[model samples]
Target chain A: MSKESIILLLFIMVLFIIGGCQTQELNESGVVAGLGIDLEEEELQVSMQMARPALPGQSSGSEPAFEVVSAKGRSLSEGLRKITLLFPRNPLVAQANLLVIGEELAKTDLALIADSILRNPSIRKNAVVVVAREVSPKDVLNTQVAMESLSATAIPRMLRNQERQMGIYQEVSLEEFLNKLARPGVDPTAPAVTLIDSINGKAIRLEGTAVFKGREMAGYLDSRESRGLRFLNPGRIQGGLINIPAPFEGPGRVGIEIIRSQTKVEAANTDGQIVMRITYIGEGNYYEQTGEADILRLENIPVLESICAEQIKSDMQACIKQAQKLKSDIFGWGNIVYSQHPAVWAELGPDWEEIFPGVKTEIKVEFELRRTYVTDQSLHYQ
Target chain B: MLGSCYDLHEINDAAIAQNFSLDLLENGQVAFLAQTTQPVPRSETGETQPSQNISVMGTGRTAAEAARGMFLHFSRLFLWIHANTLFIGENLARQDLTLISDFLMRNRNLRFQTCVYLVCGVSIQDIHKAMNERGFAITSARGITQQIETQAEELGYYTPLANIELLERMLTPGIEPALPQLTVIKEGDKDRIVLQGMGVIKNNRLIGKLNPEQSQGYYYLQSKKKQGGLISIAWSDSPNAMAVMHCTQFTSNTRPFIQEGKLNMKIDIKCELQYLETIGDDNIYVPANQQRLEYLAEEKIKQQVRSCIIQAQQLNSDILGWGLTTARYQPGWWEDMAAQWDQVFPVVGSQVEVECILCSDGLSRESFRFN
Candidate 1:
């Protein structure tokens, strides 16, 4: 063939190859916002929140934002495929933001669900993982959010917001959760979402943190305990408040806003016994004085600082006490020992679970009052 | 030059979305309301009329689905590229904002600069219904955006939050998001949409709110550019006596430092104000009174800033973005404390220093006193 004809042949071949590949238009595929996995009578029930874009030339605000279609099968992919039986569009899970696990399923085994989600090439690894508390995954997905269009999006945002504002729970992405589950020393944890009744109607709220042992959820941490867990984890909480009783003789309280904190977990071996020493250094401002005493004065700052330090130390102690009772080392104390004392971990690796419950922990907290905000004196009323 | 028009999208074939309002229905469905404007045909006299505004409502389990449900009622591709405003109902805002923010950020057509508002005390449907009944000339959402632009700087009651800014604050480690709030009030037979203070969002939910005064404190702390506002100071001895100062130029600098292994923030504020009015016999010509006036003004500002900080601490929400400042200036301290900044933020100490200069006393130097 001539040179020009050969080029023409190549162009035609490219078009043919492109035509041979499978393709779907915007209308042909359903855009998924979130997915819920549940177990019902030995079957895997999967729920998909599908986005329904407005039809061309259609007036706006006349249709629903999304439709929930669910199906049950023996496996995750099968259940997802079966969703097409009720919905016309093909299910697309790539853009999904949340993967909600039912309480029952999370308690049984998350390994199966984790494997399926990890194996799927379309699902993003950064999708948030949440456990439905006192509700099914489908119910969690069905909860409508006023601030956000999709519950899938709302759950993740809630997780992130809770992590920053409350410091009670941290959002666990699919990759992070799976990595912790598979890691040798540390276990995994996911935020727990529940439905609550409000003045308007039922609203979804992130209530606690779910602690997992291996692939199954061991228990949950309440808000205060969750804060304790967050305190131990480096870079998990950015801002939170601590309320302590008034240091002076008054029937009032003081609010201390944490400015910066550092946690140092050291594993020391002394005379054949392993001990974990957690040193927490915190700095805060004298935020509010709901008392009659003038605690903001420089003379009383040390007293106030010592009281705040005691409050934090007590919180850490309660968290450690609760963890021992639950027999779950969500704080990764084992991981610290493994890294700091490898020889010790080798001997206790097999029996770490039993040893974790009895392991001795010494927590020391030092809190300092940095400033008294804009005023050095409280308002004095006659 | 080598581009092909094979997939040409015609503007006439698409419906331009101007505004969106989201709410949660009683049946646990998302109510998505959108406003679009369409051009009217020319009259026989060859005079072109103004474009007509169309309101459409969609309901579904999620926001995207409700948007898609709009297609069942109308037949046109809803284009979001022109969408500029988002109104969130109080009921929905009290629940969570994750889904709405995700859809907005992930959607390719929607711009991140779109302004967001939290509707207080009324449903989005009520606002739309009231607007249509009153036959308002301008779009209420657009009117709100304009009002915020004009009044936010002068009044300092509330600050405008864009889609990207809200998302950044919500996602960033140390700070939380706060949006301008709107409420509809009935006046005579007409309903008016007014800008309230601000709705403080924490943990992706609306926990509390900041009144106009408190909101001004937030504005003072966060704003870096020159600001304009009026500050009123009361006489120390007399209850009724008051003096009003019109702020002409204002600037603040926040510096975070570690003093003796403790974090400390120093905020220095400098402003020039013109004395607008005085109720009592306070003379600006007198050096002692002028000095007293300056001192009182500083004290007033300090009180507002303090109250604003206290309010945030009480709500346990860091809307002031103090954590971001610490992280930016003290990277080493932040590296160790970033994870626990939330716990540290509410109690962080700061010193606020204000320098006020009375540049002018308007056209008069003293108050009018009858002899």
Candidate 2:
């Protein structure tokens, strides 16, 4: 080879080496999928859930799908350093999907826990935030569920299901949750997670809700209350089921599947007495019938509707009552008042909590029964 | 020139962050919380689980300082590009959003589309902890924030408040910024992060909020990217039966007028919707019934707009940007009253004209074909 050609080849090789050495190799560092925080015995506990990519020596034919390690220290940075001491791999969270907090930690001052998670430049802000209930976040991080091989993957999917379904639960990210926490004249809420013993075995189910009053655990809403609150909120009702007494069917109950519904909230302030009017316009189809009387009689449809409306009202009332009793404006009634009557709201802004309970509310429900299953009459009569 | 490079580090020596949050410390300093990913190696046993992250914190007098302090004892380089969202805590948002906003805007790694959330009722620390939890309760699900921002009107009162857009609104004249409200609710076994509605921010502070219903109206008047909204109307005066419409393809045209030296706004809204469902005894097969439904929609929509305007005036935060719209139409009049927008906006009267065209009702109008 000529000397010039040899120099060119060496130059190209040098360029390749320089370019490739700093490039990140996937296997060198484990991919981070999730993170968790908990305050244990006045100590900071940080946990990491990582994916096990096959690497040398440890890969040995097969490898565990995930590796979780936690460390505790006096400070958050100390806790984080201890995690590296406990685990062999460096946690890379570029692709992580979620962050979790133990209920115990959530109940305490949150600003402390958030400082560590927000300061790091390596972490993204879009990961979903989940609060563990009746269990430490670490326990939740350790358990693996079906549908997704990793707990991190499965949990986000489960959250999506909740958002698309009956709205019995809610999903929030770090940014969105913090936004609510910062804003005044409004409170924040999130869905609750609990380990349940089901027919399929121990699994994670997001149920009810956790109501917050100024960063503290103020109250809660059951599944029914959640559904009722969803009805009150002006949003799309994607899929939900409501059951009512089928008196015409002789003491049986019937279920109606909500295809879509719309709610309107209007508030008026007259002479300082606030009157809030709520209207629920629902269009649903008859999905189930354990009743006897032929609801297809056309005349019975109105009765069924009235019954449905009554049941919905009761559900809404229960949720509203709880919110008022707890003095937590989960429904944003104070905001509504402020929006409708800004001048009046200016006066009531500081004392919203005092006036929230006494504000009279009127709830009206209207049901449009679109259809009654495939057959006009229940199969029992047929 | 085969020179040795000294700055190269292995990927294992770097911390990759997935979630980032901003808060204020007690000493009036900027505090950062980052949820970073940790790669765990598999043991000889072929069993490897996935999805693990670690949180690192830093505190400094300025946001940048605190972010830098996060690496006090850590030896790895911190990467900022992977974070997907930025949360401003209650104290951070209330004190001065610019504490984090100025840094995030200047950051070269972070994108403008990063979802920015206003923390209302909970602490960012709790949010970070929950973001790391598994088996998140349905009620407490950390929902897809991107989806919520895009389809904010789905719950009736938000527009996509991306970082760039939010900053522009804060800087723009005759307009204020708003963001999706995130809160944690505890009910029984469920502790959920609910995107309740919109938080109105004026002068870099949260002044008020738009409830879900008011949020729907706010979207109609203020937001430009109007997708569709869930509209409910009373079919009759009896309040017995109602019709629900899922409307899309919305367009709003606002006409500003200088009447008697006072600001008057006439908003003309045009939208098409498919009748999704009705809870009334009225039959849809008759064309007259369809027209009646449309008329009811028009009236209901007018009422909705009126209430929305009323709310905007009450806040004295022109979130609807009515002043800006008027400015676009009448530059001379806008200049005359622009400085006095705060006063003019409160007394400004609006008239709404709605044309709701019910294009299609789903197949098989009646429950049974025989009927």
Candidate 3:
């Protein structure tokens, strides 16, 4: 062929390659932003959140912006294969923001779902995992809140908000979970999620925590119990409220908002007996009350402090009781014993279960009521 | 390059995933869930854009196969570069984290800093749906971690651990790793996610945890420098009076030594605090009050640091990196104690010295005594 003819052929070939590349773009792939898993009849029920992008101020037809596709199979891998039967486009999972599992699955075997995730070149390892409160994993994928277009992202966003704002729960990524599960001294816990119907629309909420005894679901911690544990755990707390009966006898309860708080739990091993001493120091003010309490008087300050201290101690004790009842070391007493007294751990490590329940625990709480939020006496009494 | 390279993937042919989760099903299958955003074409007059986020889930005995399964029977490719948080169900975490870590580490799209968590009580699917609604999806990057980070700064305890850091600690000897655990709480009208505590790890099995106070001490000992957090101290001159000290700057230096053939460590710390509130109607700025506050804070800090050391010794997990410290500062001693470090660590004595400075008295010197 002539030189000119060869050049024309090369140019045409390049154009063809570029056209091939254009076709390879994301044209046919269904972007999967979230995944849900449920155990039904000994089968794996897999759910996917498919995103349908809308134009910036354009009118897209009556088609829903996103679609949820689910499939069931003998195994999770089989479920994925079955999902393809429902989805016309290739399902993309790299950016999956949220992972939801049905309660039954959580109780059955949570480990089976994580097999070979580390080997998947396309999966992001940072996606957060949550437990279903009462809803099925497939249905959870279909629900969405008002502010967010995708419940996958919205759910995590809300969870992060709760963790940050209330210090209720932090991000529980796969790596963190695995680390906890593989460790001996600490049991793993994840945020529990529930579906709620609000006036705004369908919304998903992170209700509390699911406590795990080894690999199986053992129990759960309520908000109050979670809060009590939060105060005992060392982290920055934005604030929390506690309601107590009026320092003086009255028909109303007083609410105190703890603006700042700190707690310390120390383990003391003496002779053959091990005891844990918990001390909580807090600073706050009387937020609201229905009855009158004179907090401004120097004498009354002690009364207020005592009442607040009593309430805090109770909160801490309640959490401890739950942990003990479940026989799950959610508070990490095992870790405390392992770190503080290695010799004791050596003897008790194998038989920690029996010793954990009878372990001695004491609680002490102190509060500094700063300003009474304007008046020392309740408005009702005034 | 928008459809530029002949060998590259085309944008229109794939979807960008925002979130991903993996759970263990009863059938020993790996459940993989991915959240993605699908873009819609704009009309001549742009108006009325609807929802565009979706979730896709699949299961495989292994992760790679399941991902390939997601790509099967579909026209477009699944792009995972934008995926954020990843979660492993509770059962999977206990079974084998190394397996999942290996799979995730191999992924080019999985960033070293990506946030990872273990789902305990709830399933991974519930976490995905807890917030996604109306087509709006929140990726792992912009999730609740931001809130935890902010509060972590203000509280100066229980900081979030990243994937890379966690993996390193899990492998590194002389130190165990800690992870931020999360839980769900149902409020009056809605459910909320909350921080449970630090999941303390040792011997690669879920064992126990560090309660807030113990966690605070753990962080305090581990922190190279402290910025801001509150400390409550017993106020001066009164048994019932208490004072809150809002700390600002914290500097610490620890020195390890072998005295009389016994391992010993001493920590010297300097901290500054501003008076936040006083429980009693007393002048905290006075000379006597100032001395009392300083003493109280100092004593509390010293005890806290010492307690944290004891906790580390008990768990047989040196989360404070004492082994690392001795290795860096006292290499010779560390070398001799390296084999016996685990045994010696629990016996090693720690002495904490704290000096607290009351930087400010707030807006007033005296309590609300207008007389």
Q: Which residue segments of model 2 deviate by more than 4 Å?
A: A1-382, B1-11, B38-50, B73-76, B135-143, B149-155, B367-371
TM-scores of chain A across candidates:
0.91, 0.84, 0.82
Better of 1 and 3 by TM-score: 1
In order of the candidates, what TM-score does chain B achieve?
Answer: 0.89, 0.86, 0.81
Ranking by TM-score: 1, 2, 3
Q: In candidate 3, what are the lDDT values of residues B68-173, reduced to their tens digit?
A: 3343112245677666566666666655454354346445556777666655567766655554443544423245566566656677556577777666676566
Q: What is residue A131's positional error in candidate 1, in angstroms?
A: 0.9
Stretches of candidate 1 exceeding 4 Å from the true structure = A1-4, A7-15, A18-20, A54-64, B1-371
* Candidate 1 per-residue lDDT over residues B1-371, each given as its tens digit: 43555335466545677788898788867788887665444565665554556566766555655665454333345678777888998888887665465455545567888899998998998776665454333555566677787776676667788887887787786778888898889999788888887999886789899988888877777655336778888877677788888877778778888887777778887878878888876454455688888888888887787787888888888787777788888878989998777687777888989888988887876687767
Residue range A1-382, candidate 3, lDDT tens digits: 8999999999999999887863524868888888888889998898889888665555334444578999998777788779889788878887787788789988988776767455565556688888888889777778755324677876776664344224445457867776677767667777787766532345566677788887788888886677676766644454555666667764445556577777777888888787988888888765544322343466777887899898778877887788778787766777888888889888888878777777788888888888654334422110
Provide the lDDT at A289 for model 1. Answer: 51
Interface RMSD (Cα, Å) for model 2: 25.2
State in Å the error of residue B326, model 1: 48
DockQ of 3: 0.02
Model 3 ranges off by over 4 Å: A1-382, B1-7, B10-19, B35-56, B63-79, B118-120, B133-141, B224-226, B236-240, B285-287
Model 2 lDDT on a 0 to 1 scale: 0.69
